[model samples]
Target: MDMMVSSLQQQRAITDQLRREAGIKRIPVSQAVEDIIKYITEHEQEDCLLVGFSSQKVNPFREKSSCAVL
Candidate 1:
């Protein structure tokens, strides 16, 4: 268990370093969810369009690999 925790910590450190080097901004999940909910509520009475992004080709027949809201 200690080894696993250490490994996880090391991986997290590496990830954080890479993100910093790449100039990537991380968004808190709660804030993202709130933004989505607010947008939906504000546009509930009218048509709202959403665009999806994926790194790989998507097939309609297969279930999405990630959460639809993500």
Candidate 2:
């Protein structure tokens, strides 16, 4: 019982540390979906390219990137 709880806490701590190290921001699934839907709705009339970044360093939208889009 106590051991199980301790293990879960340790796992959560490790997950959080990894996310921090990787610059990953955690968002709720519903919020992410809603944001995507909103973006699509706003741009439905325009030709859109959904660019994806596998890592933050390559993302142009990130302010920290050297080639960030202004």
Candidate 3:
């Protein structure tokens, strides 16, 4: 579990660095999180994906899985 958390953090850092290098407009983390919650609240019955990181070795999703890492 700790290793998976580390991997996800690394992925976030790399992507954030890339986005900064590209000079893209960045949203505040709080606002982004709010948007996600709002979306999920409204679309509760639909399938939604909010993948912060994709790991080849440790995918946390499974069929009918109720786990949400956030």
Candidate 4:
């Protein structure tokens, strides 16, 4: 459990670093919604309703911090 937590933290740090280096700004709610729409359209056979729900529930606040990655 300890190792897992530590690994997760490291991954989060790497992700944050990449995000910063690539100049990828935080994803806006509108953009996320649009991306979900595109994804659903491209994968028509998939369950889009569930994907939409999950996408909407993605909390930007939770993603802003770097604690760790698994």
Candidate 5:
């Protein structure tokens, strides 16, 4: 029993040391969700529509937008 407890403690210490060395830390779940939402909103128009839309839909919009002027 004593040996088991010592082994568990040693394992925990090693895990903690590894996490610290790797800069692995926990964030609140809400913060993670917020970051994901912000990233999706920022990237959605450029990544999703640009690839998924038909050229017919895309070319007209592009012609009306800054890309046309460029």
Candidate 6:
């Protein structure tokens, strides 16, 4: 268990370094959820416009995979 935790910490350090080098933004999940909820509430989707969503079976954490909410 100690080895696993240490390995995870090392991996996290590498990930943080890579993200810093790439200039990526990391949004807190709570903040993102709050923003999404606020947007939906303020927009009040009463117009009943075309709402579309699609997703594929893939590891969302993969750098090559993507998702959009619009």
After superposition, candidate 1 runs with Cα above 4 Å error: 1-21, 48-70
lDDT of 4: 0.77
Per-residue CA lDDT of model 4 for 5-53, tens digit only, reads 9999999999999889899667899999999999978887565554443
Q: What is the C-alpha RMSD of each candidate to the true structure, in Å?
A: 14.0, 14.0, 17.6, 18.6, 12.3, 15.2
lDDT of each: 0.75, 0.80, 0.78, 0.77, 0.80, 0.73
- Looking at model 1, residue 4 earns an lDDT score of 100
Clashes of each: 0, 0, 0, 7, 0, 0
Q: Per-residue lDDT of 1-70 in model 1, one digit per residue for the tens?
A: 9999999999999999988888977799999999999998888665423443342355344566675664
Candidate 3 residue runs with Cα over 4 Å from true position: 1-20, 47-70
State the lDDT of candidate 5 residue by residue for 1-70, as single tens digits. 9999999999999999998988967799999999999999889877745566555675545555445543
Better of 4 and 5 by TM-score: 5
Q: What is the lDDT of residue 6 in candidate 1?
A: 100
Candidate 1: give the clashing pairs: none
lDDT of 2 by residue, 1-70 (tens): 9999999999999999988888966799999999999998888666324545667776666776367667
Q: Is candidate 2 or candidate 6 better by lDDT?
A: 2
Tell me how far candidate 1 lies from the true structure as C-alpha RMSD in angstroms.
14.0
As for model 4, its CA RMSD to the true structure in angstroms is: 18.6
lDDT of 2: 0.80
TM-scores, each model vs. reference: 0.36, 0.36, 0.36, 0.33, 0.39, 0.35
User: How far is 57's C-alpha from truth in model 4 (Å)?
Assistant: 69
- Model 6 Cα RMSD, 1 decimal: 15.2
Give the candidate number with the greatest TM-score.
5
Off by over 4 Å in 6: 1-21, 45-70
